[model samples]
Target: MRVSAKSDYALRALIEMAGRTDGHPVSAEELGRQQNIPHGFLQSILADLRRASVVVSQRGQSGGWRMARPASDVSVADVIRAVDGPLVSVYGVRPEAVEYNDSAEVLQHVWIAARRSLRDVFENVSIQQLADGKLPAAVTSRTADEDAWQPH
Candidate 1:
């Protein structure tokens, strides 16, 4: 499945923030500059994250945006969902919401399983782990096989 640019940008922004040691907010423009994302686009993404309670916005000169919770408590899945919608969707519909003909019914299960696989990785990983360049065994193991990094 293809990940949306918005979700990718959100993850990058979160990772950048996760690396911060000063506990100070970072402006959208700064985040965009650091991640090479468009400033306006980053602002929109930040707004979405704010509404989701994933990031809080601070006003005035000394304020900007910061994670609402600790980096360790936020998962990539949370940031993605906050900026982009569900983790996995087919034809704009959730896998479970789509029904198929009797012969093609198994396709729905395939989609569901695909979503579960995505969840297993995204949900299990936290921003802190990402910032620290450390991933859980389950995540690294998936990439243990050379074929796992190859284009299908």
Candidate 2:
């Protein structure tokens, strides 16, 4: 599956926020500068995150943005969904929602299984884990295979 730049930037911004020791809201400018995300694109990402309740915005001198809940409660999947949409889609429709002819009926299962595999990693990984630079054993184990690092 292809990961969008929006999802990558959103996760990077959230990880930065999660890593902050101070309980201060991070300004968009600061987040953009730190994460190397374009300001305009980041603004739209932040807006989407805010609308999804993944992040909240504050207004004023001491105001900025903060997670709506603990970073541990927000998964990479959640961040991606907030900024993008469903994890897997066929022509904008969900894998299961897509109809197929007899010859292609089995292809739907491929999409569904692919989505499940993605969730196995994305859903299990939280922003806090990323911020702390510690991935779950389940994830690490997958990377242990030598072929995992090799390009397909």
> Which candidate comes out best when scored by lDDT?
2
Model 2 CA deviation exceeding 4 Å by range: none
Query: What digit string (tens of lDDT, one per residue) describes model 2 on residues 1-152?
Result: 88999999999999999999998999999999999999999999999999999999999999999999999999999999999999999999999999999999999999999999999999999999999999999999999999999999
What C-alpha lDDT do the candidate models reach, one value each?
Answer: 0.92, 0.97
Tell me how many clashing residue pairs each candidate has: 0, 0
Instruction: Give lDDT: candidate 1, residue 22.
Output: 96
Model 1 alpha-carbon miss at residue 13, Å: 0.6
Candidate 2, 60: how far from true, in Å? 0.6
Number of the top TM-score candidate: 2
TM-score of 2: 0.98
Superposition error at 16 for model 2 (Å): 0.6
* C-alpha TM-score for every candidate: 0.97, 0.98
